[model samples]
Target: MTIGKGLLFSLLISLVVQGCHSVVFKQSFDKQKWNDKEDWDYPQRNNVVDDLVKNHRLKGLNYKQLINLLGIPQGQSEDSAGIYYQIVMDFGNDIDPVYTKNLLIGFNKDSIVNSITINEWKKP
Candidate 1:
């Protein structure tokens, strides 16, 4: 291959690979940012979700501590499995919600956190 043509091919291949996956920056968990609403901001929970769920970080925290860290949850998970913090809600163009994502925190009988998961629900 000619030098110029080889360079072009490599650039094309790099661009294609980069385009295949979306880049999501994982932010450090910030309690204040998680609840800041005055500036019309959201998605803070979604950003820090990776940090919270990684390494079973929330496993030993009690319900009260969880509340202290995350504030009051948006609501309990369906089937009463766990409490959840609303991470993101996508409405798109239509009025009804098209998808919803939440941080579901499950607890044991002693009210200590047992599981933490990112629950994503999408409309059919």
Candidate 2:
């Protein structure tokens, strides 16, 4: 065989091997991440919020009760009268698009929740 032909053949083999290696590595890495308990595990903290929404009911729940249940608001906002607690949750897949649910629990002078608004809620 000619040296040039051998070199070209060797280059093609190397490319093919490298491509196969890349695919294998990607699959294994993704598999490891998927199998990992920490990655797949739902946040225990979120269950408390879930329980509130599922069991306790959102609209009737008071401000102090929510604070006690969910630990604390990630952040807070205030208007002319009183403050509001932000209940933010993430729900989406890896590619194409990501989504979230943001609930605003507003309070009046007595600290009872005056309104519960599902702001930017995407889930059905």
Candidate 3:
């Protein structure tokens, strides 16, 4: 191939690869912002969930302590024996959206936190 043609092809490939990549910016968890109102409406939880799980030692905290730090969880959606804090709920025209995300905190029998996880639910 000609020099010019090779350079153009390489540039096109580079641009295509870069454009295909998805960029995600993770934020630090802020108590004031998270518990400002309610979790179901707060969409920033997805960005800060990593920071909360990584930076903070949530495990071993009792129910009261967990509540004090994270506030009330989704009592109705308490499935699989874990407290769920909604991170993102895509509400479209319909009553229920196909996509959902949450931060799930699982506790042991003693009411002490044992696991903290990010749970995503996608339409089947």
Give the range of the ten consecutive residues with the poorest summed lDDT in model 2. 24-33
lDDT of 2 at 47: 25
Runs in model 2 deviating more than 4 A are: 1-51, 57-62, 78-99, 121-124
Report the lDDT of model 2 for residue 86: 37
Q: lDDT scores for all predictions?
A: 0.79, 0.49, 0.80
Worst 10 residues of 3 by lDDT: 35-44
Q: In each prediction, how many residue pairs overlap at the backbone (N, C-alpha, C within less than 3 A)? A: 0, 0, 0
Query: Per-residue CA lDDT of candidate 2, range 90-122, in tens?
Result: 545654224444446777767777776545545
Query: Number of clashes in model 2?
Result: 0
Question: For residues 1-124, what per-residue lDDT tens digits would candidate 3 score against the true structure?
Answer: 6999999999999998897664445888888767765634875676778899999999999989988888888653466677888777876666887788888888888888998878798877
List the candidate 3 regions with Cα displacement exceeding 4 Å.
Answer: 1-24, 38-40, 76-80
TM-scores for every predicted model: 0.74, 0.38, 0.72
Instruction: Order the candidates by lDDT, highest first.
Output: 3, 1, 2
lDDT at residue 84 of model 2 (Cα atoms): 40
